[model samples]
Target: MDALLILSGIVVAIIGWLWLVITSLRLPVGKLLLAALLPVLTLFRRDQGYARAPRLLLTAGCLTLLVGLAMLFHLHPHRFEKLVTGQWQPDQNRSQTIDGEIMGQRFRPERVFWRGDDLVLEEGPSERVRRSLKIRFAGAGALLDDASIALLPNDPGAWPEVIMQWHVGALESPGLRRVTGQYSLNLDFAPAANSGATLRLHLTLPSQHQTWITGEARLDQTPAWLEQVRQQQSRSTAVRERTATAPRQSGERPVARWQAISVLAVLDEPSVVGDAAVRVTTVSGRAHEGRFKGVTDEGRIVLAQAHGPNQVDLQFHPVDIRLLETFQSPR
Candidate 1:
């Protein structure tokens, strides 16, 4: 803990001590400075000694010092501690925990620690053996994201991810269960004990609308992998902040969330450039077509233009629309 954080406690103690000396001992204003600077000298001043201070003032001073001392010891977690850690197991007991099937998973985590938008949780030594139902997470943003990509089948995203993998004895390996298909995800987070957090994840593949993972993960610890991830996220945030705030040179536009330009370059046919396209019609009955890229949070319609292998997204305000039609790829 930083001393600067608890510095006020120390200051309060000193101020309270001085106040007691002046009020209780009735020290002259001129001699108050001497007492404050060298409280040890009070022992020789019989009339001004602490023994003469008021009982109430003495008690208040002692309490202040005790409070300050406790703060100095830094008994709480650090400010940066934000990770959530704890045990993760299947809700097999039908305790009304949702798809809480498959009981008796990994041993309860030994510890959970969190720091700075990151968390780590490690199960009791049991996950080491060959038969435990183990689940591990490896992503930044204090939640799952695309970066946790692995070749494993259980995980998702544009690349490979290890989803549900089971290892058993040479001939006892069990077939993977409830682990198939791409999915859409939803998460609910709730605060837990010791500054930890509980993550409830629900996944369903759009095609089948079937649940893949209805599980809970509690995190509150420092993990080696998450440490690297946390540092990277911190550095990225610093860089982005600096870039957005740096002084702009002459003629440089201030940063904007979205922008448009004139004299746009030409592109290949929409079918050749992208897998999806939208034709938007204005109230005036005029239509414009382009590759569809969905709509932005600000209600701006996004279209894309392919320049060989590269692409750019174009935006349009929603007010301009009278109708819109779209075409999407099956793949």
Candidate 2:
């Protein structure tokens, strides 16, 4: 519908300009160019003679109206495209971000990340109009006319399909606040743990006249992916710091880098240090690769499990401990 409207508008504009040029070419070529290109100037050129002046003025008025009408359409929001259906599937690792689907067919998202409880998804829509139209501007007085609607979709009809920009995570719900990045969209709600392993997201059209899309994804690996995203952010920060101070250490050897590690534990449960990738060994030749939380108090070592957000204080003793080695950062 949008394409048809634009195509027809262009055709009409071209025909109108051509007709004006041929019909009024009896005047000097320079005057004809001025009248056609800058119709408003024709209004001031009454000296061109009253013979064709009124007709030319009338032509200028009509042309001005036509241009203004086109501008009005361009400035307002209009439909862009029609979505078939949408779906999402987990990546090969079954964690991190998932692949997108259109009408049960596989597709891809431009970018994906986790921000707090919401999973962010982003995809660039094929532009029906020029890219510059998406940018909004502001200025004093008439300059404001050059501005655009910030929330307006580049393709008006597919506005609902632009999940990232619109934050359309649920049906008929307000969009969630975007944390960062253009085209990034945050899911309004996270899946409840007991709600089942499969998490379903529904996207409804704001127009309320189009079909809604649903995407079901796995939640089991979401937490792990969230942790990975945080780790990436930490790495990025460190790199930026290194880059900023590069000039000062131009001839020096790179310094050893160490990551901040943490002991993650649930209340009343043993605190786990590192995962399988990292191994911790004791003096007794005992090697452990999983979570192990022991408390040291006075002269005894007490071990227990943990859960939730609570902390436990227990006694611990150093008995024939051999070694405590960590190859990677702890979570």
Each prediction's TM-score versus the true structure: 0.29, 0.28
Per-residue lDDT, model 2, residue 262, is: 31
Query: Can you write out model 1's per-residue Cα lDDT over 81-154, one digit (the tens) per residue?
Result: 21123223433443123242122232233333444333323322343422222233332222332112112223
Best by TM-score: 1
Residue-wise lDDT of candidate 2 within 1-331, one digit each (tens)? 4344445555554555555556657888887887578744555566573245345545554555556445434442222211112223323553323344332223344334433333444443444211101111111111111111111112211111232233222222333221111221212223346642333334333333232334545544444433454455467667857865666456665553333233322112334432223233334332323233343333323332122232222222245233433344223
lDDT of each: 0.42, 0.36
Off by over 4 Å in 1: 1-98, 102-198, 204-212, 250-292, 295-331
- Per-model tally of clashing residue pairs: 20, 24
